[model samples]
Target chain A: MYKEPIFLQPKFQERIWGGKKLHTEFNYTIPNDQTGEAWVISAHPNGPSVIKNGPLAGKTLADAWNDHGELFNKSKDNHEEYPLLVKILDANDDLSVQVHPNDTYACEVEGVPYGKTECWYVLSAEPGAELVIGHHAKTKDELTAMVENQNWDTFLRRVKVTAGDFVYVPSGTIHAIGKGIVILETQQSSDITYRVYDYDRTDSVGNKRELHLDRAIEVTEVPHQDADKEQSVSTVHQLTVKKLVEEKYFTVYHWHLFGQASELKLNQDFLQLV
Target chain B: MIDGEATLTVDGKTFEVEKGSHFILPHGLSDYDLSGDAEFIVSHV
Candidate 1:
């Protein structure tokens, strides 16, 4: 019997490649200039969003999901945790080249409920901004050999991007967010990242970040292929709906409201995030 | 909502929302009404 919208407070995370754009662009009171990501709508144990209104005010989204399952149309047969996470990332510098495991690997090896299969909606980008999208390896052996030989230039595929662009990075896809890019990301609620490579950047303590080479080699898709997402567009009243990517885990849409529209919350089992 | 202001009525409660406002309309809620001029980007599972 729930009504009213649920507004959640974002939790910020700091990273070496982070910047102040989350604050500058979103007017969020970022913790520091190095803040990298704002977990806007999340229920992960690492950083759950706090509800800001109604009877659930002050409760974490995790609490609501576990306690008030009906709000999410959860039934007794479904025991899985919340299925999605939304984030805003600001890459002041290049992020580490990385890949993530799929559900089977994540559960069997990492003991996590879900694996990370994420999509990015570029909020803004600097001129010539590029991202590591995939690799040039023809096979798993080639991929391993290139990684072992440190032949980065010949092994990685970089793509130029700009504002309003959308990229879908599926599980096992070797990818990285290049410098000076800000994006909104939607993904499975998991944080298991296997860093394939870092640009030899050292921390303040003069220690280089650890690289999960073995796991990365194990999970990365050899001869990486870009995901094929067929976008569809439609309009209802003042809202222009753009279907970005529809996959097994989740379907993402971009809604552009020009004037006004009366939206009905149909008897769907899942809640909507804005 | 991304831009402009709006009054959102859910059940018998009302909320004032403006640009940059992010919200989730819970499942099973009745037909909520939004009146005003605004832009928004929304997603769901």
Candidate 2:
């Protein structure tokens, strides 16, 4: 029986808003100065994590899910590509205002298995750091008018963030991560993003990024609703555990171990990404 | 014990782990041994 924990090597992605924080903070050997995200525990085809130890060493997480289905306790009812992805994002600049489709919309329009409904655990933030959460649009017509007019200052809602703060972002929410912040993100496996605005920022080659205005309008919720989350704390073994959010996509928790704790590898019927 | 040390033994192979070290004990490994003290965080799906 496979009982050893699988440690995976992270895959990094370069972005226009990327920076060197991933290297300075996590001591990661980043690919470049524009490294924006580390796909820490992921099985997505774009950047699947490679197992670094044990019998699975050198194999991508996607490989294991496809070949050794038993490891994740894959059964008839759970046969949708890998279900989750974990990432650490370093936003040196603002990300483009974007939204994502849910499962039904994704499968019908994007031909993907899942949609993005992510939550962020703030790792660190500079003083007065903030992020774009919801929009100020009270109705679909208002949202459309604001986007058409490019009225960003009056349309976006920004929220201040600090270390240890948690934010749940469900699908169809128009959001973006502002500059000077690093976040640990957990979400559904799909990566179908529909960009609404890009701040007129051009790439190194001076080309503006594409905006999917039509799709964004179709998928985004008419009025934004913040996720209602009530965290609960508990002690398990010698670790302090805090439940972050339990939603349709996933249940996330933060564990702080103060001493040595022996944990048995039980058959959980599901894989964990840490 | 973020400031302490711990020795983790998996399948009879033991190693000393300290603060800021990140390691995984994969599934299917036998009951392992962890001695000493240390601090860490773990998350699972």
Candidate 3:
């Protein structure tokens, strides 16, 4: 029986708005100061987390999920990619306004099993830090017009955030992580992103990144609605558990340990802890 | 999870989890132990 915990090595990714906070905070051996994200517990094909211990050491997370279904309590007859991913992001600068497609749109167009629905647990946020959670457009046509005109000041919506905040970002919500924020993100195992705007900033190579306005507008939900969740907290011995979100794609929890908890029983489903 | 080192016990084996270490508690494991002074975020599909 596969009883040991599956340790994963983070896969660092560089981004235009990336910074050195990942290495400074996580102590990861990053490739450069521009490291933006660490795919901490991922099984996606783009950047799978490598197993770090036990017999699975050196094997990619995808390998384990494909070869050892029992470990995940998945049926042998079922065939699907691992459906959850955990990431740590350091946004030193503003991220491009972006949106993601739903599962139906993803399957019909991108031919992927899941779309990007994600949530973030703020690890650290500089004072006055803000995020573009949604937009002010009342309709799709309005949103399209605002985008076409580059009317960001009046078209975008912003919210100030602090450390220890939880943000839910459902697919189709136009959002961006503002500068000076580090977050631990739990997301659906999909990499498809539709960039809506990029602040007219060019990369180190002096070229603008491509924008997926057509697809982004097509997938974006009109009249943005905030996904508000009622949080519930409980204590299990010394560990205080806060249920951040339990949604269609994933259920997330924050565990604050005052000391230690021993002999914790596991449920049938596999859990990714980060 | 993200934080200081956490001591974990699975079956009869013990593992030391460092800061920023992320792991999966796969199925078929009945009970485990976590002894440390740290925080963690756990999720499932």
Best by TM-score: 3
Off by over 4 Å in 1: B1-7, B35-39
By DockQ, the best candidate is: 3
Give lDDT per model, in order. Answer: 0.85, 0.79, 0.90
For candidate 2, what's the TM-score of chain A, rounded to 2 decimals?
Answer: 0.96
Tens-digit lDDT track for model 2 on A1-274? 4555566788999999999998887778999999999888789999998987768889998888877877776764666797888888999998999999999999998899998999998888999999888899989889999999999999989999998888999999999998999988889998899999999999989999999998998888878888879989987566566888888778877766555557534444553534
Question: Chain B in candidate 3 has what TM-score?
Answer: 0.87
Predicted complexes: DockQ each: 0.61, 0.34, 0.85
Chain A TM per prediction: 0.97, 0.96, 0.98
lDDT (10s digit) by residue, model 1, range A198-259: 99999889999999999999999987877878999998777677999888887888767666
Expressed as tens digits, the lDDT of each residue in A1-274 for candidate 3 is 5678888889999998999998898889999988999999999998999998888899999999899888888888879899998999999999999999999999999999999999999999999999998889998899999999999998888999999999999999999999999999999999999999999999878999999999999998889999899999998878889999999889999888777798898874898889
Better model by TM-score, 1 or 3? 3
Query: Stretches of candidate 3 above 4 Å error?
Result: none
Which DockQ-derived CAPRI band holds candidate 1?
A: medium
What TM-score would chain B receive for each of the candidates shown? 0.86, 0.76, 0.87
CAPRI accuracy category, model 3: high
TM-score on alpha carbons, each prediction: 0.95, 0.89, 0.98
Tell me, per candidate, how large a share of the native contacts it keeps: 0.69, 0.33, 0.92
RMSD of each: 1.7, 3.0, 1.0
